[model samples]
Target: MDITGAAAVVTGGASGIGAATVRMLAARGAKVVVADLNEAAGVALAREVGGSFVKVDVTSTEDLVAAVDEAESLGPVRVLVNSAGIGWAQRTVGRDGRYASAADLDAFKRVVAINLVGTYDAIRLAATAMSRTEPLDTGERGAIVNLSSVAAFDGQIGQAAYSASKGGVVGMTLPVARDLAAIGVRVNTVAPGLVDTPIYGEGEASEAFKANLAQGVLFPKRLGGPSEIASMIVEAVTNSYLNAETIRVDGGIRMQPK
Candidate 1:
């Protein structure tokens, strides 16, 4: 699909990979709506890209629906990027020496709700809107890109909830693509490795952990940048043939068991 003048919605656009996607899509002449919970950063990015900002909590259906409405006001949402996700570092059992408690269950539920269900919400709403647009030469009306992680496939210790949530994303791409095919909408995902995003803490990793990561990659020998991931997303949207696939942009890193 040609992105020029297309309306796009990028969730989690306030920072990190989402922020990079917003910038890249805007530069490609797509009118972007930066949907995020961080009001300040969302508005700032909106200004930077000459796009709109919709303060949205992906976990809240009301918030997501409202964001879709706001974005539709700008233009038809022909592109949807589900980049809002949270990372967790706790085991099913907690560091507090307790088994998975009610609080832990709640946290897991929240993560699944935000990362998986929330992504579906945006896709459903945006595809509905896109279906209303005239089809392009490739019979494509729109495209949706979801963010997964290498952890989805190669989950380490202490990543049960995070991995499960992202795995759900990876698993859904093909089915979602098939479901949307008749309407000329495509769905795909990107599974990134240790990215230079704040999802990891600011401090450098321990030498042991760094060495472990190094062993997984054949080259580049470092974390990926948000721009690199964004580039893949752009290609996924523009390349009509690239559908129902999860492209791993992880510098050949297949993570180790921690």
Candidate 2:
């Protein structure tokens, strides 16, 4: 689908891969909305791209609705990127040698709620808005790109919650795409491997740690960049033929069990 002059909403757009996506979309002439929780960063990024910023908590329907509305105000709502998510590391059972202790149920629930449920919430709302728009010459009203992780497939130890949440995204792509076909809305997913994002702290220690992580990559011997993932997302959105597919941007790395 052509992105020029289309309104695009990208959650978690203040930083990381989402930020890169926001920049790329704006560069392509899409009127982008940087939806994120970080007001300071979101505002800065929005200003940088000459787009709007809406503070959003993905779990809240009201917040998402406002974001979609904001996007529509810009022009035809044609793109939605669900990139807000969190990670947790814990075994099903306690790892501190405590017998019968289980992982923090609340943490597990939070991760799934934000990563899985929140994503669906955005998709539903955005697609609804897109359905109201006239289809392009290509007969496509819009496209959605969801952010998953390689962990969804090769989950490591202590990644049960994160994996389950992302795996849910991969699982729903086909069904969601099918459901939205009547409206000419397509859905796809991007499962990225390790990328240099703020989740890792800054400074020498962080660089050293990231280097060790990069050693596992199959080629180039480096961690993926946020722009790399964003490029794939743009492709997924613009390539009308790409639907119900999950593309991995990892450099041929299968994670090991931690």
Candidate 3:
């Protein structure tokens, strides 16, 4: 897919990987819409990249539609990066009164809603919009990139909800790609491992916890940077043959079970 001069929409484009992707798409000459819940950051980033910002809550179908409409107003939404999501860590069941059954279930639903369902919404609507677009010389009308997590595969003890939501993302990639194939649209996912995103804010995760997390990385013993993950997203959009694949950008780090 040729992104230059294309209309692109990135959800969660206010921070972390989403923010990085917004910049990447803008730098590649794509007209970008930064959609996120954080108005200040979203608007600021849009200003930075000379793109537009749409305040959105991924769980809202209306918000998603509005975002798509905005992107189409710029032009057909040819590139969509579904990065708006939430994370939660709690075991499905626990001993010593550790488990909160109802709370856990609620958390699970919320995670899946935002990560899996939200991503699907973006892909479906964006593809529909892009369907109106004539295919380029490369036979591609659009590309969709969704974010997963290494936890989808390397799920830790307390990451049931997070992992399941992300796993749903990984599970749907191929089918979604096949569905969009005939329309000259592509869908893929990026499952990042231990990356230095805002999942742990400053002075949030303990120093020891951080060290332990990085210790598991097989090499380059550190967390991944947003730019590193963003680069792969750029590739997923630009590299024509790459579809329905969940590429792991972990540093050979197969996580340890807790």
The candidate 3 region of ten consecutive residues with least summed lDDT is: 94-103
Sorted by TM-score (best first), the order is 2, 3, 1
Comparing 2 with 3 on TM-score, the higher-scoring candidate is: 2
The residue pairs that clash in candidate 3, if any, are: none
Better of 1 and 3 by lDDT: 3
Better of 1 and 2 by lDDT: 2
Kindly provide the TM-score of model 1 when superposed on the true structure, using C-alpha atoms.
0.92
Clashes of each: 0, 0, 0
Q: How do all models score by TM-score?
A: 0.92, 0.98, 0.94
**Model 3 agreement with the true structure over 76-191: per-residue lDDT tens digits:** 67899998888887766656565554346777889989999999988888899999998999889999999999999989988888898999999999999999999999899999
TM-score computed on alpha carbons, candidate 2: 0.98
lDDT of 2 at 220: 78
lDDT tens readout by residue for model 2, 1-258 = 899999999999999999999999999999999999999999999999989999999999999999999999999999999999999998898756776588888999999999999999999999999999999998999999999999999999999999999999999999999999999999999999999998899999999999999989999789999999999999999998999999999999999987
What would the TM-score be for candidate 3 when compared with the true structure? Answer: 0.94
Model number with the top TM-score = 2
Superposed by TM-score, candidate 2 places the C-alpha of residue 119 at a distance from the truth, in angstroms, of 0.3
The residue pairs found clashing in candidate 1 are none
lDDT accuracy of residue 69 in candidate 3:
90
